[model samples]
Target chain A: MTGLPMVVSAANLPARVRIHEVGARDGLQNEKTTVPTEVKAEFVRRLADAGLTTIEATSFVHPKWVPQLADAEQLFPLIADLRGVHLPVLVPNERGLDRALSLSATRVAVFASATESFAKANLNRTVDEALAMFEPVLARAKAEGVHVRGYLSMCFGDPWEGEVPVPQVVRVCKALLDMGCDELSLGDTIGVATPGHVTALLTALEEAGIPAAAVGVHFHDTYGQALANTYAALEHGVTTIDASAGGLGGCPYAKSATGNLATEDLVWMLQGLGIDTGVDLGRLVATSAWMAGQLGRPSPSRTVRALSHKEQ
Target chain B: MTGLPMVVSAANLPARVRIHEVGARDGLQNEKTTVPTEVKAEFVRRLADAGLTTIEATSFVHPKWVPQLADAEQLFPLIADLRGVHLPVLVPNERGLDRALSLSATRVAVFASATESFAKANLNRTVDEALAMFEPVLARAKAEGVHVRGYLSMCFGDPWEGEVPVPQVVRVCKALLDMGCDELSLGDTIGVATPGHVTALLTALEEAGIPAAAVGVHFHDTYGQALANTYAALEHGVTTIDASAGGLGGCPYAKSATGNLATEDLVWMLQGLGIDTGVDLGRLVATSAWMAGQLGRPSPSRTVRALSHKEQ
Candidate 1:
């Protein structure tokens, strides 16, 4: 029993969704073990083969910041030949942007914090300073004929500051879009968001003249609200969803807790809704199972666990 | 940080949801360990203290079928003193109903399967035969002036049956309502349902004259679809939700997998939506923590894992 969900479509949702697969870049960055360069390249290839079009390949951040993804230069060229697949890499600043450009990367993304506390804590700068820092990177990427994506972290709530105001998040989003970035991915960094808060943020963005087409949602499963929040986002007409394969991101505090929405889980919901994602569920599960075996642990995905059990 | 989700209410949802906590009966019934009668009593008391108005205490089925809760006669008397809380016990047939009525139980429920495969597998009887068997039980309970809840399992998809039809589920629901049931709890026993399927079934139930107020949703989390399906049910105006404390039910094949939706996770979502559930989140977390300790394992709930870590 492959154990797929039965199809039943709802009204007002997009017939097709472009899943922004972030397993290699976002998922493995938080891992305790550093995977080899060959495995990382193979992972990107497998994700492409599974029919994920927009796969975030890796980060060009300083090795000191994310040592796990330090093999970006060695890993990119290995999977760069994947035709018809959009491999988006994260570029922290102009230095990282230069590195991605050197490799002929066509798509790049820069992450910014919505709240001041996270800006200071994560990037050692204020909100404006962080945006100012990404200015040159986005400008250079746009000049180089590369698509740019802006990731707005802490859109829902921040750990240091309890509940984030929707207006405050909207300001950062507008600044990012104005700074030469093409689209924005709203990140619930700590996974503290609920459906209404998700709706509130998306509605606020709409009021600020941002359409749902240019927005993607990145939700963590820290509190098990990711899928429900994703459903709410879809209801608001946001089609691009960011998910990590096998729910790869793990909480540093609790190893058992998942830090990202599992891609397999998302595909199950989409498949059941009769929405086309173009990703083969069987191949995706197999890829996650292989990746989980490499990490010497089980994937934090319920769909993976449930389906993989039947195959065995 | 207690890691509580910030409140942001959704539109057109119920102002308050009735949480039918089923930790003591449905949750513990799956465990291989036999919890003592005193511990079960204390668990019920603690759940009441945590502000759960309706707790499914224990089942009145034969000791041979459910050895874990065979001491229902003893357990019921111990917690009957708790005021202002509704304790619903499951009664399988006439014998089980007789046991429940003799114990002076105010509320009783009968479990049925919506699919023929599950009906044959679980009860060793056809769907019609199973319904006929419950006729006398439901009638006797009604005559005793007790509230009857009809539980229809495999409401969405069954493992052996794949996808259960919306019409098929509605037929059983109508049968239950006609046979003296005050309400129906639709159970997605395999956790394979998606949002559209949930809405479709709810719509069919309404067309069959079963109002949302007369329906509760019981979802498993095997494929991580419970919370998302729950949101869909909420959108369709269903107010009563069934959850297990500490996510007590575990998949026998995969211990890491959760078989029931966690009450803490559901509470976090409800509280974030400003939906009044009369539940104290802090106390509920502590109660689940203590229950997890009694079971000699960490809770499978992400909310339990996230919050309990901060407390420690």
Candidate 2:
């Protein structure tokens, strides 16, 4: 990885980007229907086979909270043996972390909301309370030699609270990073982020002593600004991006949170920009197409739709 | 416009942009079901009412070629008196130009291909032959004191040729500019362009002595790169953008040309960036929704889908 040339100038962006695939967890958690455990395992394997190195497998939250991912224990062991891939599961608290550890999970993620409304609605706690809840989870994961990721949701806007201030997001992000998480993923959970807002937040993070290297952007395509915001983030020297296969996932909280930035769409732009993502776009599109068939709907990704139509 | 502060830096982009709304012509041109002439005029009026200053009204191509726009002659006079809006019509040749002149059309557009295969398939002529055919039409329009726009199609890639060379596109764009066309719209007809390709082409255009002001970008959303490509164009200081209402239009020649860049999508990004496009985004979204109902399908625009669903 160090041997490859790095082009960080405005004219030339980073030569490579780390695509953090979140299809199995973030993508399916909001889904209304419960996907069978066998299909969930197969989805993770296909994503890895398409050259995706990091795939978030599932959440270990209680079934009462997220019924769609109730079979995480059954799902994890199915794809845990995939070679050269990092499969991370979401663990909200110590109990979830305990569940992850029982499965011998190598990596785990904990999520916190930046806005009070989202924290209260989504996590049933205040912002501070949510962070306090993750404190022990992070400590246990660190003590167990497990890599941990922290997700800051509603970093751009909130459904109840309009536009989230950049400083507010930075403060929450700094708290998460200081809590010993390996990296932080800033999520525009409501999908209202614009390029300027993304730029402002990334700049604020830099000023708040959170380096771009420790940050990844998770944008929803509700307003079709995901790719544009990603472009802005890349120009700011961010090399990690979170995307879902087949553009899966919608926020049950905000019906307008249509889908995450599709991995195929991200791969298309990266491949065109001469950035190395190591993922095979054709196979990725095929995988999304197959998933769409399973889900009984066309993928919401323009690249997937276009490529599939071309094949026909 | 002068009262607005102009931002012209790499980090801070242009303060204003010109949105060349093309729903009336380019948007409805490829629809399988013919839109009524009265509805077409009303669509143009609604777009203008939404604060768009320039709208392409209709095309005067032969009825057999573009039957959807066959009512161009009748559609022109109905909206000719629209206040503060520049209504341009597409004219294919001397005959079409004559029709445009009879209606006192102030602005006209002629299209040429950057690839030979598209030229032969769409225009039934070689690239040079198509340019020659437009020569007399451009001369007549210029002699009559009419504003003209030259469209260079397949500027990014050709279905048959694949990955068009920048030099080849530059030469064709140079020819169009040299022919007294007031402005040139470089089209990613197949939606195959990435930001890097956009930047490279714009830089090459600059090196070829064509100012960014004379170039407008017309991107299709087949790969969902339209907004990102537009962002790249703005970074290069190109401000004029061509979009269609409700993300109308698909390419008949290229099966992958799913939709044009929706004006609402572009407006959403520009408004968020604090770029002054003088467009009412709510009104634009409503117009697109109305048009979608008329077209008997949901809009393909993510912005429109998000906003409309939010209202529900």
Best candidate according to TM-score? 1
Give per-residue CA lDDT, model 1, range A1-312, as digits (tens): 246788999998889899999999999998888999999889889999999999999999999999999999999999999999999999999999989999999999999999999999999999999999999888888888999999999998898988899999999999999988898999999999999999999999999999999899999998899999999999999999999999887632352475799999999999999989999999999999899888988888888888887787
TM-score of chain B of each: 0.97, 0.94
Instruction: Estimate candidate 2's alpha-carbon lDDT, on a 0 to 1 scale.
Output: 0.85
The parts of candidate 1 lying over 4 Å away from their true place are A251-258, B251-258
Clashing pairs in 1: none
Q: DockQ of each candidate's interface versus the true one?
A: 0.70, 0.43
Candidate 2 residue A149 Cα shift, in angstroms, is 0.6
Model 1 scores a C-alpha lDDT of 0.91
lDDT of 2 by residue, B1-312 (tens): 111111212365888999999988899987767888888888888899999999999999999989999998889988998999999899888998999999999999999999999999989999989888988888888999999999999998887888788899999888887778999999988888888888888999999999899999999888888999999999889989999987888532233557899888788788778888989888888898898788877777777877888777
Look at candidate 2 and tell me the lDDT of residue A259.
Answer: 84
Q: In order, what fnat does every candidate score? A: 0.73, 0.47
